[model samples]
Target chain A: MEYLLDGFADGLMRVLRADPQVMLAAWVTIKVGFWATILASLIGLPVGFLLAMGRFRGRGFAITLLQTSLGLPTVVIGLLAYGFLSRRGPLGFADLLFTPSAIVIGLVVLAVPLVAVFSMTSVASVDERVRETALTLGASNGLVAWTVLREARFGMMAAVLAAFGRVSSEVGIAMMLGGNIEGYTRTLTTAIALESMKGEFGFGIALGVVLLAIIFVTNLLSRYIQRS
Target chain B: MEVFFLDNVKFRFETDLVLDIERVTVSSGEVVLLTGANGSGKTTLLRVMAGLLTPEGGVIRYKGEPIIFGKPGLEHRRKVTLLAQEPYLFRGNVLLNVSYGPRARGMNISQANEEAEEAIIKTRCEGLIHRDAAKLSGGEKKRVALARALAAGAETLLLDEPISHLDEENSKLIVEIIKELAASGITLVVSTHIPEWASTLSVKNVRLAYGRVV
Candidate 1:
């Protein structure tokens, strides 16, 4: 108990002093989470809108595929990405194996289905009249869709926050694809995993605190958006 | 001259027939009243005419040209506006709701604002222009919605039960506004259950029973 308390205190000190390695890992973690979430939204929002609004055949099958993808294991995504990015693989010409970009690719695969499914549900829940009213008011079909999406923006932001939370803390993709290279691809979650395994409790605890803080701020922002 | 005509119209919901009007025609700058009891499909007919609901089978022609449902429907839809029985306001203030139509049609900000303010005055909702639309009372919301429709400046207006559930004062206000709008030469199609109030206006009447013109 005494050792644990001493280690926690030392972790707080390291976090406060902004250790270079710890800061680098934090930056990488944030970069992966942010880029993955942005890419996911870019792909997810339009797909979600079409799923909710367009009258297309096989939509149910598409929706089922998205929902199933939501539960896909992170390591499975990492392995699939690794398979393509590996030297002997089809995409080897890009030379992106075991890099931060590989981790971002893995995280994006994990986040897209999550964001798309949540956004579809959110946009679907809006009242049908909102779209009708916009249409009656001379808004084009694109403008009508824009109107509905705008009305459900709080819910969409919630989807983004959920996506960010998911990718930021997940360890499987980071460990498998990032290779946890120091000063390059090292991220907070992988660092914590390595430090704890090596019994460097103070270092692991500090990284954990940083991770928690990022999630905390993200959730706080989502709440503010929702309430507003 | 005929503004539009629906010929051989048929609309159904699942196995239930909602509308089966053989033919209906409206001229430019005319006032037409749709009156029927509950579930008589007055609302459905208005929606179909507004192009909000596509009939299972029909051809709607505007000035002797066909209005196709997929892309050409937009041209007809832009010229016709529908005000639902239940008022729905967007996320912002009353001014935003009123200005939505003009802004959506590509009007500049100053032009949209001018039209919105004029509509607020016309609807007698001047004081409510800056208030949050979502927080307004039902009657207030209805008035704001009317202002929005009027500000749109569509050639044809479809109003569903515009004065059905309001107080006498509000009903009188809406009736006067409707009369004014009709006198200004804008085509009006109003749906209401109360025949007594509708009888006061000199307009062509169409009564429906079970989705068919009677």
Candidate 2:
């Protein structure tokens, strides 16, 4: 118990002192998580909006498929991405395996369904009268769609924050896809895993603290947006 | 001039027939009052007239040009606006809500504000101009919604249950506003459940019973 307390104190000191390795891992994590979340939002928001508003054959099937994807394990995504990005694989020409970009690819796969499902819920919750009101006010179809999206803006933001939270904290994809390469592809989650396994509990705890802070900040922003 | 001519128009909700008018006409600059009991299809008829709903089968002519059932042109929409029974104000201040119609029609912000202010004054909602629309009382929301429709400058207005839940003073104010609107030669089709309310306005009455003109 004393040793654990010492390790916790050492972790706090290292974080306060801005240790170089911890800082580099944090920066890489932010960069990869940011890019993955942005790419996923760009693809997911519109797809979710269409799924919520559009009426067509097989819409129910598409929603079911999206919901199922939300529960997919991150390691499975990492494995699939590895297969596609590995040398002698379909995307081997890009030579992106064991790199930060590879990790980003995996994280994007893990985050898209989350963003899409949340966005669909947000848009679907808007009052049906909004569409009718816009139409009666002489707004074109495009304008009506824009109006609905604006009304659902906070929910869309929450979706983005939720995606960021998921991608930032996930370890499976970071480890399998990034190979935990130091000074290059290393991320906070991967570093935490590697450090703890190598008996570097202080360093692992420091990175864990940073990861928790990132997730905490995201949740705070989401709650603030929802209240506003 | 006949502003709207509906012939054999039919509308349904799933399998339930809602509006089935054999014939109806509204001449330009006329006030047509639609009075009906609950579920008598008054709101549905107004929605069809405003080109917001497509009738299952019918020929609707606007200004002598045929309005295709499902494809009411933008021009048709711009010239006709509907005020719902429970109007929805956008999430913004009253000025922004009232200016939405003018903005949607491509007016610049300043010009739209000018139109909105004029309409707001006319509807006696100038005091609520800077107030958030979502914070408005029920009567205020209705008046602000009317101001929005007015700012659109449409030649025709379709109001559904305009005085349904208003206090006596507010109801009187709305009736006076309707009179003023008619005097200005804007075609009006106002719906109400009370037959006595229709008598307050010099309007031609169209009574509905179970989706048909009685």
Report the lDDT of model 2 for residue B170.
81
TM-scores, in order shown?
0.92, 0.95
CA lDDT, every model vs. true structure: 0.89, 0.91
- Candidate 2 residue lDDT tens string, B14-102: 99999899999999999998988999999999988888788899888889987643334677888899999999999889999999999
Report the lDDT tens digits of candidate 1 across residue range A1-228: 988998799799999999888899999999989999999999987888789887789999999999999999988998888898889889999988878898989999999998999899989999888988998888887788889998999889999998998899999999988899997889999999999999999999899999999999998988888798
Candidate 1's TM-score: 0.92
Query: Residue B63 in candidate 2 has what lDDT?
Result: 93
Provide the clashing-pair count of each candidate structure. Answer: 0, 0
DockQ score of the complex predicted as candidate 2: 0.73
lDDT of 2 by residue, A2-49 (tens): 878988998999899999999999999999999999999999999899
Q: Which residue ranges in model 2 land beyond 4 Å of their true spot?
A: B69-72, B195-200
